[model samples]
Target: MNLNLRNAVISNVSGNTQAQLEDTIVDAIQSGEEKMLPGLGVLFEVIWQNADRKDKQEMLETLENGLKK
Candidate 1:
């Protein structure tokens, strides 16, 4: 069977309120399961695509700092 993970992930979270979305992300992170990474990546992709230049820069800075630690 063919599966589209990114679309599936987006569909799963579609129409979620801010709090619901935040909880989903937090839960995924706290779970520390590799299976959740793709979903997180998809979410990040959506954010990155919509983010302004400043937001993208901040995200990159945060990621860089995180990797340096």
Candidate 2:
């Protein structure tokens, strides 16, 4: 089944810390949960919007590697 990525992401990620959320994202990806993948985009947008440049870059890289596996 297809999922609304942005909305689902926003809802699931409401209270988690960055590290916690990253772990969750990695887990989701490893499990081949397609519904959870797009939510990473939302997480990326949120972190990019709010984080310092260094943090954003680091997170983005980590996310990219996570998604690729």
lDDT, candidate 1, 1-69, per-residue tens: 115998899899999999999999999999999999999999999999999999999999999999999
Candidate number with greatest lDDT: 1
lDDT computed for candidate 1: 0.94
lDDT by residue for model 2 (10-40), tens: 8877898979887987887788877666766
State residue 1's C-alpha deviation in candidate 1, in Å: 8.3
lDDT of each: 0.94, 0.78
